[model samples]
Target chain A: MEKVILIKYGEIYLKGKNRKFFEKTLENNIKNALNEFNCVVSRIPGRYEVSGFDPKFSSKILSAVGKIAGVFSFSLASVVDSELEQIENISIVETEDLDGTFKVVTNRADKTFLKSSMEISRHIGGLILSKNKSLSVDIHEPEHILNIDVRENKKTYVYVSSNDHKGIGGMPVCSSGHGLILLSGGIDSPVAFFMMNKRGVKLHAIHFHSFPYTSNLAKEKVLDLAKILAPFNGGEIGVYLCNVAKVQEAVHENCNPDYMITILRRAMFKIAERLSKDKNYSMIVTGENLGQVASQTIESMTVVENVVESTPILRPLVAFDKTEIIDIARRIDTFETSIKPFEDCCTVFLPDSPVTKPRLEKVVFEEAKIDLEKIIDEAYAGIERIIIKS
Target chain B: MIYLDNAATTQCLDGVVDVMNNYLKHDYFNASSVYAPAVKVRRDVENARNELLDMVFASNHKLLFVSCATEANNTIFESATLRSGDKIIVSAGEHPSVFECAKQFQNNGVEVCVVDLLPSGEIDEEDFARKMDRRVKLVSVMMVSNETGAVNNIKRICKIAKKVNPRVLVATDGVQAFGKIDVCVDDLGVDFFVMSAHKIHGPKGIGALVYRKDIHISPLLWGGGQENGLRSGTENVAGIMGFFEAAKLSMKNQKSNFEKVQKIRDEFIDEFQNSGVKFSVNGNGSPFILSLSFDGIRGEVLLHALEEHEILVSTGSACSSKHSDNRILSAMGKSQAEVLGNVRISFNAHDAYDVKNIVKIFASTIEKLKG
Candidate 1:
């Protein structure tokens, strides 16, 4: 009566020579997710089976499996010996209370078995029909499909995959590269972190906080967002909180009022670029969308991003609409935390009329009134680094 | 730390903890259970109830011990059976517990009217008298404004409302006025008086709703017939005993504590005047609390600035600090800047901190933030 979890992966089977690399990353990621539980993940030829866990933790393990990238689907299954009688009994137990149309699916990897795959399915189908008079066989589109996976390990796993057990199908995290994500306590940035993480880019976060102008609750809100996005990034996200109040104050006092957002964004990007270089992250990620605000326009993006000379700026939601980004935010459970209305650094000294399109030289001239290097260095020296785990 | 946010909550007095432990450890019996110890516990709870009622000089009223002031306020409205087209009046400067309840009543087809507040944060008695009518079933006004410490003349208010419509029931939220000033519910002529324990150095999670005996109030919670069928569930024995101890101490030293707190408030104002920082007093009423406004500085920023030096204060009432807009300040005819720049510095009778050190911190922090 041992129960296990059966995990199936997609897209990785299409990977060419680096298939093992993806599989290993996915295996390590899943292991990290279920590290708190007492279980073992064993490879079973084109699938992975998690066993030796307490029965009470079966649902928890399946939930963790459901959050993992590169997984197509998973099931809570009962493991039995390869004998037909044992398989028949477990299949009956699986469909004991279930009624309606069902089809028995069998994959016989054990060649020594007497019956073929179709023969096993037909035999189990007839036996199940006789036992439950409420059920009939529907091979085309069955309400329930009882999958009996007979592996080469001399064990057969009988499991049922409910409609809610589908996995988040994407590339395995950390398989692509590492990124430094500019996370803000807003609706867009956390969703951007999720998008980059789904594409196999592991992320560390950086948030700019204005303390006296904003409160401690604003910083806590950003930390909560990081905690929510950590599970997709292998259960941990390193966040660096920079107090940019001094820089913002300098900009507010010295820079042109119309170019306030542009100069402030330039300063943030400069700090982000420096941090990414020091931390050895490959790229910088943001939740910037096209024409969303005055700071997200084509000219604004050009002027703001020009400060980073070496790193590539990745805007995953550049072409997305506001509603589309919000949908992803709601799905990832960061929408509630993001909409907390706590003021962040961006809202501290918002200009009444910020320039949407500015000349590069004028922007540079306005940014030079304040000692950008000195202020950014002072802000950078006071980084409060925290590691948030889900 | 110089904790000046006493109006939000005060630290539990030392003796209150011991009193609470006595009930929690030794006399831990369910008051409803049929046993000797349970009977003793029930009698102790009743004795505590009687002692609390006596503290307010409310011999003609009965007190129901509930969870907190918020629940007590809600129960006042819940106990009253008001139909559609019936009217209620609440002061514009009420606490959210009362203000939100008024809004809920208005949404449910009752005609809810709001009385105005003067710039001094006192209730406009003329406006209150004008709003009084036979259709108005209930009138809720706080004895002390939580944001500014402005004491409304509840005795005068009750007299005027009763003259207009003697059938009207009047409830006064006395959370800030309970221990800070002399409170005689009989003298005030209020049908319902709500008070909390935590604001007066007592234990939290316990409050009382003292109502006149002649009035009929239905139970909000229906259960095992506790609180004589007014409120349900087992009595909070430890909380009751702790509250009684705190209330006893506060009542015994009311006169001396009031003089000390008044002197401390005067010292704060005199020292600020000498510092030449240019600040305005928001309102004048109770000596236990003081609200100040600076011309260009944000109160929250000043609060954080002082917080770095281990001085804790509040921008407004702690419950409404999370909200950026100040409804009470706005209703008092203050400009948006004045509302945003207002900070409340409240005093506890038991505070032993030096006024000079706190004023020095305030001056230095304001200087730094002004840059």
Candidate 2:
């Protein structure tokens, strides 16, 4: 018997006519995740099987595959010829360390193998019980279930389905179209990136930094967040950094101080839209939650997105509460890096009280006070693209 | 580029780098091994230790090399045999390494007395004397205020503590004072002294804790019994050699370097005064570091503005820059505006930058930021 890993999918089965396309994308994603490991991932009839890897690297391989989206469940099992004695021997070995009530489950894909599914299970269960002398059969809520898959490839695979080996159930990355994330070195944007990545959106990021007002460390912190999210996006992410210090300086000098964040955000969306068009991204993703901050209010968001007329602005985290967003951030391992205290562009010329509900006409009037279009063009012209490789 | 953040760290001298490279590339022998080359390396380490001890006039004390000043300071607290009822004293202006340790001990039910800081950034000697008692087991303070470069009278503090309780251990973190000033641990009367290499022109990751020979402190790490079983790990042979070279050069030119730094400091201050900016010197102590407080401008914004001209400065101690509140400045009773506007510009003894340009950039940046 040869040791192998079995991968299962969830949402792709419902794709109907687009199943082939999604399956191909998932296979490529799995390959990318496990690119460092020497192994072969082969697509069988209903699942994918990974073989020819060193036994010492089994756990490492399993962990890398577990992070890929669309993988419903996966298991490390041993494959043998479609024969009863071989299956029974492996099942007995699989239950050698068990001491509680157990059950044997058999899936007979090759009906011509002669023994019925129940017959094979009964034979395997009796043999495991006879050798171990410590197990009893419990079909309902068994402590351990020894799963047997007799496939149409004339091979039977045996593995114990562990509840711990669960996958992150979502569509595979790159299944959806590309978008640009307005990533800030804050708690929300990286989490927004993660949410969209889980929904199969291939996302690049644009960060606005006000150096000499903000610091280089803030830019680095946002880049670090992008690096942390790279693994979920096939092991690399491209981030663009635009210095909005002049834009901020102009607003701080000319406009009312309270509209600093409002006007600054409008500048950011304009730059993001320009870069997205230049790079062929169809949407602009943000982590702007409703009423989380002054600039994130429904009215404030309305004023911010009014500048981006060409592409759709997606706020995946618009309805999530702060605590719920933090929960996902912690789960995705971006919470710790996200909370690093560095001043972002928004905090550069922050006023004492920002306008929670901004009128679109007043914001446009403020925008007219400064040469915003020229400043934004200059900011976009100085964009620094950093590729964080996996 | 002009580097005025010497109090945070200094660039290593070319000669020190050569010595370190020799040890790292050729004489890479484990000091604990029983081979002839290893014996030679151990002998070299001992010689360097003696030389460093002589530099501080601490031949009567035993020195234990550690990772850095932070580790040495932490080791001092970790080796203290204090219990619930025992009392320790630390200054409010102490570095976070010493101040935080005292706070943690207080959390574990130790009686911690924090002496206040005078407006000149010096430790309040009267308050320190008042806090001294027979119940105090340890007295910890820093030799210099890293925030304002105020040199404390460690000899007097040590005498006061010992007179109150002869058994009390006196430790001083001399990271900012060792090579910058004339450091004589013996004359200072400190029972335990901490020093780092990088503050001078030595390599990072090497510091030494010198203690009186008769006093015995327990080990924080137990491994291969290196450093007299106190700090048990492979000896940092290259770093130790580099530290010895840096200390040697620093002492050789200490008197002349002091005069040079004082001259530059006077020029910089004179130029700032002539530039017509209304500013106050936070603490009037050591000429090596100057802390200036502008009334309405933020120190952080000013620091970044100066960077536009390739001049590096710090708003506070590098360790406390990320923290909005400056504990040292606050302990000196400065107001919130003064604390927020304070900037620290330090000078190395071997500095070779033009002082006029720095002040010009400083004044212009402040003017622009104010506007």
Candidate 3:
């Protein structure tokens, strides 16, 4: 018997008029995700079924489909003829091992099928009860749910469950717009990247790595975290590595030691804003959660946010707590890579105690100590572009 | 670049590399196949194992080459057939592989006890005597301390342990001792001993566990029958060959190289003292390893300072540097400031020729850093 996965998505169904466009993007993404497995992906109303791939790779396809943002869940299913007897037999086999009270949900997409959804559920439930004496029927709350999807094209997919893959359900990538994330190698930033991508923002990231201060291992760690989020974008993560040594040197030489992080973050925003303008990105996203760290406080974020003149700043994690960010990071599989202990550019010269309530006026005054234009121009000359393959 | 982190790992020798490259280029057959070509590869694997055995002079004990010293340590520690509440003792300064595994056994209801080390960084016999009881099932101590390079009296420890509890099985991690010093499993009377090839100028991923032939060990990795069913995986043919060649070379040059490196190590300490720096050595550790600490400068900062001059060094054990504080060094009673300033300068035979020149750069780097 041939086997396949029947995938269903949530939220996209509520788009109404633009549902077609969202479905098209999602289907293309699912196909791209499983392109290496040689599967035939066919779309129907409210669902898509993957077939022609080897049954051995069903679990592989299931995991791949689970990563895309539009995915609600997927199931390993067997394709059978639409006869009620065929459906009855498959349903019996699917729920034979399940115990306690159970429920059978039958969705009839085929109008010409001989039985109503109620009749089909009753017949299949009777067959299952007779075969397994250990089970009782419970429509309200059941220990196991055997789902039956009866489609129009003389095909029925019978499975014991539905939508097992709980993904970041929002919208499809590239469906909303394009933006850039200041991808720092930390737990919060990668989760922010995943959250923004879930909102349909196609993203390219940029990082500043200082060689003498930060090791190459630190850079490798950032690229690794990006790769974990690459599948959701349907390709590799695009990153631009900028060397800001001259900027850092200028700050250390001229700026106050306590203002190191404050000035350093300002320099990053200045560079990011210029790059955003050149790339035509509509906005900038950061992993800043309110009061989570010294730089993430209201006073600090406002100062950093003010450096970028016009591009809107999005802090997806602003309302989230550290555990919530970590939870999302763990769900996206980027948590482990993010926790790797390597020095990022900002961490190399971390102050003993940074200003928690950093006044913008005072920060602006500290900025006057360094030659801003010369540092920016010299640092911009050292920008390096690195393409991270999935 | 000048690499001084030999205690962490070493560059694979050209001879080992040539052997590995030859295996990669032409010999691609699985050793388990019944074909003649495959049988020849199996012979090569056995030849490698025998060569390793010869280097350790443990013909009576069974030697199985596994993957790295960590695996070898785990295999030996798990071989002990101890029930819940049984006592097992390990030195406080054991490598993470042995120390961590022993601690985990406590979760499974085994009574895990740690014996402290002497101020000189040697295993404290008084503490061991106090810890070891009649119910102790196993005892593990490294042959040489990886952090301090202190030569552990494994022979004496095992002798004392067996005298106290005749049924106690003793195992030692021989990673730091295998190439730098002479190792004979039979002479040591240790039931189990482990060594890694990388520490001895071989590959990074291959190591061996030599144990008494009568003991039975549980296999962690199970698949098609391999390594006499103790470890079941495709024989890492290239890695095994690399390990074999590296072991052979180390055995041939162990004595002369040890003496030559020892001279340079002494000179390094002498020159540093002559530079008039307020510093002190950690302990009378191994001659190959020189652990020195400056007064106020952090080891990591000094490590980078030397790196600026194209030199590489490590601060304490490289494995534990990032994850946590050096528990072994801390347990030896080194203060916080001392621990932070502790830098390890381990020597290699190849680097011994330029010892004076490297020491000169090191002294200047310190002055530049402190000036």
Candidate 4:
């Protein structure tokens, strides 16, 4: 019997007019993912099916499918014609090894088929029971449920399980737009990268590595995190490490102690915005959880956000609680590397009490104490680009 | 590439690849099978084991060939039976395999204590004496430091440790010292020893744990009853053949290669010293390994800077380089600043590694970095 992989996506069904565009992009992505292998990815109405490859590489192909962004769930199924006899034969052959109670689920997209969905399910289920006399049926809670998805074009998919992998369950990356994501070696930033990536923005990640004060291990930790996030990117995710030590040093030396984090954040935004405009990025993404710390407060965030108004800064985790963000971090395999106690540039020369509520006008007045342009220019000059490919 | 990072791992010798291919392609047979061809492969594996034993003058020791040095280290710990009050003293600067394995014992129930290292990165004799007690069942130390290359006085340590308690078993990690220097398990008086093939000039994924015949050990991985029921897994036959070849070559060429590598290492050191760069040699270590530290420059940054000029070196121990900090350097009482600026440059006996060219690269790289 011939086997094929059935891919099901959830959100593109709601795209309406742009639905065709999303489907085309998904097809192109699946092709690129399986480029090394000899397989063909085709679209049938609302779903995509992968076929014509060696069955031995099914697990390998499924792993590649899971790395894709728009995937909801994928399944390996036996493909046959819409004829009832053919479906029954294949179902019996597939489920001959399985024991205990069982049921058959049928999704008949082709209305012109001779039998109704109920009739197909009962027919396939009865054939399976005939092959294995010891088995019975359970509708609500069966030990096994064989799913049969029938399309309008005389093609039918039969599998033991419908849901093979629950994907990242977001829009495909690079569909939204391009963004300059300011990544840090922390618990929240990598999660933010995934969150923004889920929303379909191709990320140009920038990490501010503070050497001498902070070690290269800190930068290595960020690179490791980015490697985990790279599988979801439509293209390779290359990170730029900018030495922002001079800017942070200037903030600590000249700015008021209460305004230390506040000013450092403003300087970072200025550099990120400059690079964003320089690189033609449409947005910014940060792992800033609202009110998680003094600098993340509504008033403090405003003072920092006010500086980089040219580009839209996307803080995906702003409304999320610490525990909620951590839940995602652990799921994505970034928690252990993120928690390594290597200090980044932000941790150096920290203030005793950073300003939780500072006016933009006063922040501007404090910023006049140092030359932002000169320090930012120096930091920008030292930007080292490292490409991380999955 | 001016690859001076031989201590990290070595490229296989010229004919070692062909030797490995011969076994892998033609003589592929499961040694456990009772067939004629299988018996021949088993004989070849046993011959390799015998050759390895003879190299270290360990004819009385029973050798169990494993996949990696880490696996060998873990197998020794698995072999030892301990009670709740039993103690194990491991050197603070042992590799992650031995260090973490000892910690696992501590977690289970054994009283594990860490003996300190001197500033030169050798296991401190006084600290070892202090940690020795009737409850201590095992004392583990490395024959040579992988990071700093400080050759430990294993003979003196075994003598001192035996005086305190004759029953305490001594195992030495011989991965770094085996091929680089002269090694004899009997002369060193170590009960158990671990060594890997790639550390010399053989293929990777091949290491052996040679223990005395009277000392009992169990298998960490239980599979087919191979390696005399001590380690039960399919023998890595091709790698063992490569290892046997590399062991023979290394033993035959140890003295000549030692003189040549030491001379090259000294020349490179003199070049750095003459260039007026603010650098400090970390430890009086093995002549083949040199650990240098610049006053204010980060070792990682310097390593990358040198890599731009095609010189490959290392910053700290590669195994735990991604870990937050250097536990070994800190344990040796090196200050935070010195530890941060450390880089290890190791040499091997290869025709491509010219002493004059490597010395010149070191001088130019240091000059560019300093300027």
**Whole-model Cα lDDT per candidate?**
0.88, 0.87, 0.82, 0.82
Candidate 2 structure quality by residue, lDDT tens digits, A1-390: 788988889999888888999999999998888777789988887788889986655655776776687888898999899987888888888888676788988999898999999999999888898999878888998989999999888888899865237887788999998999999979999989988888899889999988878766577678778876888877789999899999989998999999999999998999999888989998999999998889988999999989998899999999999999999887776886688777888988889999999999999988899999999889988999999865
lDDT of 1 at A22: 93
Better of 2 and 4 by lDDT: 2
Considering every candidate listed, which one attains the maximal lDDT? 1
Recovered fraction of real interface contacts per model: 0.00, 0.00, 0.00, 0.00
What clash pairs does model 2 have?
none
Cα distance off (Å), candidate 2, residue B129 = 58
Which digits, one per residue and each the tens of the lDDT, describe model 4 over residues B1-371?
88878888898998899898988899888776645577678768876887788678673466889998999888888877766779988998899999999888888899998989898889888988888887778888998888888888988888777767878888999999887788877667778999999988899999999997678787777776667666787888999999999888898989998888888778777877777667777666677688887777778878888888788989867787776477888898988877888888888887456656665666677667667
**Model 1 spans with C-alpha error above 4 angstroms:** A110-112, B1-371
All candidates: interface RMSD: 28.3, 26.6, 23.3, 27.5
Worst 10-residue stretch by lDDT in candidate 1 chain B? B31-40
lDDT score, candidate 2, position B129: 96
Model 3 DockQ vs. reference = 0.01
Stretches of candidate 3 off by over 4 Å are B1-19, B22-371
Cα lDDT tens digits, model 3, B75-172, are: 87678977797999999989899888997888889999999987678889989988888899999999888888888988788878886787899999
Q: Comparing to the true complex, what docking class would candidate 2 get?
A: incorrect
Per-prediction TM-score, chain B alone: 0.98, 0.98, 0.96, 0.95
TM-score of chain B of 4: 0.95
Q: Say which prediction, candidate 1 or candidate 2, comes out ahead on lDDT.
A: 1
What is the lDDT for B293 in model 1?
Answer: 86
